[model samples]
Target: KDSAEVTIKLKNNRRETVASITETIAPKDVLISKKGSHPTPYDVIHKAADTSNCINIAFLAEGYTETEMEKYINDVKTATDAIFAHEPFLEYKDRFNVIAVKSVSEESGTSVPSKGIWKNTALGSNFDTFHSERYLTTLNLKKVHDWLAGTPYEHIIILVNTDVYGGGGILNYYNLSSTGHKSFKPVIVHEFGHSFAGLADEYAYDWEEIPMYPLDVEPWEANITTLADFKGKWESLIKKGTPIPTPETKDEKKAKNKVGYFEGAGYRTKGVYRGVQDCRMRTNACKEFCIVCKNALTKLIKFYTGE
Candidate 1:
């Protein structure tokens, strides 16, 4: 197909010659491999809400052979249950549609490049992303999206079959997590906060020196703040008599669940602030999301489903 981009001409003014942009389209055959393999089928694990007006989360299988498809399905269920067990998701359980896309592979584990190991996974997931050993991700976005073509999905969770304690999440893109780890449930929930609501990482890191948020501008994430502009953030959630830049005192330790601006957040030791002293976003203690995170997630759900 070929089409010409046009510019509107007003009747009061004579038609002027303007630049034209052309769009070309072509049809290409989608050929299957000589091995006679095709895209795997998907299954609806949980249909709590209708596809037309719900947040559809599709879980894709990685590093799981055909024989382990059953296990992959069970892992998908565990992830689904773990996600909804949290605060905002628990309250809005009926507003989500969970699916499991069965993209089987020939191998049973992901690539661990640091250990000189490789596997023929369906999505080509690997560790040592950007030279970080624990950072897990997949660069095969086209393949992932192609597998999800027929499914109703806005977010993706790629469940790897290995027991390695590694996972990664990108905002509105995808979440990659291992299903067999003991901390998989809590870890997936933490990563989902990033991919689903664009929450910043509350924990500080010591290894890397990548600049995250600028001190002059307000961050768009609802969980962390630099105090650049706290007008629309969790400022309203702050309790009365709670001082700004709340100190980490004995009383603060006693009231660990309070919604005060605790220093040391967003992968920085200072300047940035988190809503609470401890939360799922800050650690893997299987804790509930802070009040700020819960409220933010609630608003995000309402934005998606009007519920």
Candidate 2:
């Protein structure tokens, strides 16, 4: 079937068919079996206050050989520490469970096509995705899902054992990050913002003219806005005295930190605006999520844990 059709059965035994969703299957999208594969064991890195009532995140090891399992565990620790050290997560540390799955690979580093280097990583991740050198990602969704078949996980984080600086995340899908980069800690948290809370990238790129958000329609994300439907966004969080389109001036530095809409976000220099002038989603230096992102994350956590 070109699309997957799902049916919902009501309590009264009534059946309702929902719209079909298309599935894009690539030639590389082959399924791998864990049976007799001697799948590596997993460890509970962070024990939630109540595993039955809290969010569970699983960090899967990629591109790390069996001998380098120690390094993989340490890398997971660094990523976990960085996550809980920030707000929203810090306040709700007890409401999360982190696990590290030691999925040992035959090789120790990911493929860098730009440098003509390739390794037999557990997950076949590589750089130069879509011709973008920094875009690191993997097409092995089946392998990722197969590894977490019986785990109590709602999120997946693949830690690639490479020092090259690159990572990518798709909301509620997966997070792929390098383990040994200088910016690894911050980058993981930033990518987590994308995967965990559906937070949009707050950074703007002047060279590209990518229009991910239409000016007339509101973005589904909680952070960036187009003023088309600001009412549903963080408009109420804006300070009383703050300007609508917060200026990029030194004079408004204090106000910039406030919950005012700052122009330049979502890779666009105009129309789109983010909740704060600086945030973890915007730059690597900012280690904290903006108030708007924190609020959204809190709501998402509550939804997941029924708290």
* Highest TM-score scorer: 2
Q: After superposition, how far is residue 268 of candidate 1 from its true place, in Å?
A: 0.4
Query: Can you write out model 1's per-residue Cα lDDT over 1-307, one digit (the tens) per residue?
Result: 3344545433311223454454433334245223214535888888865667899999999999999999999999999999998998998888899989999898999999999999998999999999988899999998888777766789999998889899999899999899889999999999999999988888886675345666666677899988988888887878788876787755744556678888778777778889888888999983788888899999999999975
lDDT of each: 0.84, 0.85
Q: Please name the candidate that would achieve the greatest lDDT relative to the true structure.
A: 2
- For model 2, residues 182-225, the per-residue Cα lDDT tens digits are 99999999999999988999988889868877787778889998
Model 1 accuracy (lDDT, Cα): 0.84
Worst 10 residues of 2 by lDDT: 8-17
What ranges in model 1 sit over 4 Å off? 1-39, 206-210, 249-254
